[model samples]
Target: MRNYVGAIAAVCLAACGEPGGTDVSSAPGALELTREADGAASGAWGQGEARVRFASRRVESGVYRIEVRQNGMSLTGLVDAEQGVSSLDGFAEDNGQDTQMLDGDRELLAGLYAALGAELPAGSALAPELKYLRRAVGLWAEHPPAVELQRTVMGEQGRGYTMLCGYAKCNGKFTGSCGTTFNWYSYAKHDCQHGGFDLAANQQIAQLGDHATCDGDELYMSGGKWVCGEPDHQSRPKVQGNCFGRCGPGCGGDTQYTVDATNHDGCVRNGHALTSAYCNDQFTAASDDELYAPDCY
Candidate 1:
């Protein structure tokens, strides 16, 4: 029930992105709960980073660890914003606002620990609310559709490996007690409602849009927004033209060509931005905005 992918929604949340943009955060994964807590490791994420990684290793058989190294180093953080502002920002996900959330959690954690072979410390964060989670996990496990979240899927790694995927109703807000009611009717309906998860089997992964994978982009989600060190972007279907000038090896400086513009790709070389106006000339058919940060897709 964590909105880890919620970061990308802020810029175009109500505005509607590109009219036909690829639905980025809609994918469902088991590592969602884990990533949400890791990226936004405050408030509801009482589990902490250490535990999340340990539990994660149990799921994909250390495949996640391998992917991190394959990717870049800057992608360490996934989602995070500020005080009291969780990934489900502008909605709800703190323990303070809801108590029922804390109720059955004990059992929920138990089931998770049992499945992952992780041992819950005698004293752990959110331990008080666990008993609350336990009951809910049981009901969801016992019930048919509810039991679906208790679901597990074979990982992309193949070899018949599986990952645990789970879900519950969370409206980013609680009417009174945690389980008492939901703020958004959609979440209460239990049809994804922006809470379904899609665990990345790798160490870290994200996307800027349908155009580019966040692999080497150092992209992350924070306070319902995507955060990246550089504004580098690639077009969808992977633009297959000559990657020239700043987009390739110049940022407009003494050593590099880093031009500060929406259409300029934030390509960096020699520790400076790599950009040049010549790129705009190459893709004459494209709008200036579309060329922003045009790099080798």
Candidate 2:
């Protein structure tokens, strides 16, 4: 499912360079996040196929331990009650985009594409769109939601993917990569935390260690503050970068926190009883708010 605040970013590499060897093993109900690669693929170092997977087990009510394993890399971390403070903390800068990992979480999902063994569109095909969109927003120069949490790249092909829509199609339109739908004001104002996004460009730049100038969106910041507008690829004939970012000084962490907490508390209270009633309807499943349910099993 698409992560809310701690969705994915700043993946914390364990000291032992492997998952179980890290703190995740100590969690009360430490469930393995990613499944072990099939033994058939074991000892096969040059497979060249990139697939990413992760999983988490609740340690207690409102608490979880998460881990991501892909290629030969692994990262482990925990999600505390308030969704702030994670061990995978880090700051990443690319192109003109600047993003943070975990406030406790901002882009744990980006680690997916970073390590994905999928068939990626050529960088050439990826550049023009990025170049165009960057120009559209006057090259806003701030990349929000550094990680693209749209699909889990399972293999080196298009069919080798799945959607992380924790709820249903969020906002009735934009698929939460932050915003790709032309007029995403509703989504930006309501559902950008789902950790999914729609990229107009057929090609995407794996911004982790392979990021080029062709990543991020122009609309991410306009005269300061998160906004949604102009040249939406899903609407207009241009590409738009509808990415979100982590908590920080000018990033509006305080306001976003207030908005998030209010919605989360509402869900923690009675969202299950009232479906589609609140804008945060998906929080129960997406954010694992169901853990707060009387019978959370």
RMSD of 2: 18.2
lDDT tens per residue, model 2, 1-297: 112333334343333233333333322222222223321111111112433334444444444455444433333444443432323222221222223323222222332222221212112232222211111111011112333222111111122111212211232234456243233121222232322333221111110111012234233233444344332222212112312211111111011111222222222222122122332332312222111111100
Judging by lDDT against the true structure, name the best candidate. 2
240: Cα error in model 1, Å: 66
Q: In model 2, state the lDDT of residue 79.
A: 44
lDDT for each residue of candidate 1 in 1-297, tens digit (9 for 90 to 100): 001233222221122112112122322212222223332111111232211111111112111110010001100111111111111111012221211212233323334333321222212333212221221222221121111111111111112111111111121112235443311111101101122222111111211111222444433334555554332222111110111111111111101111221122211211122222222222121111111111211
Model 2, residue 153: displacement in angstroms? 25
State TM-scores per candidate: 0.14, 0.25
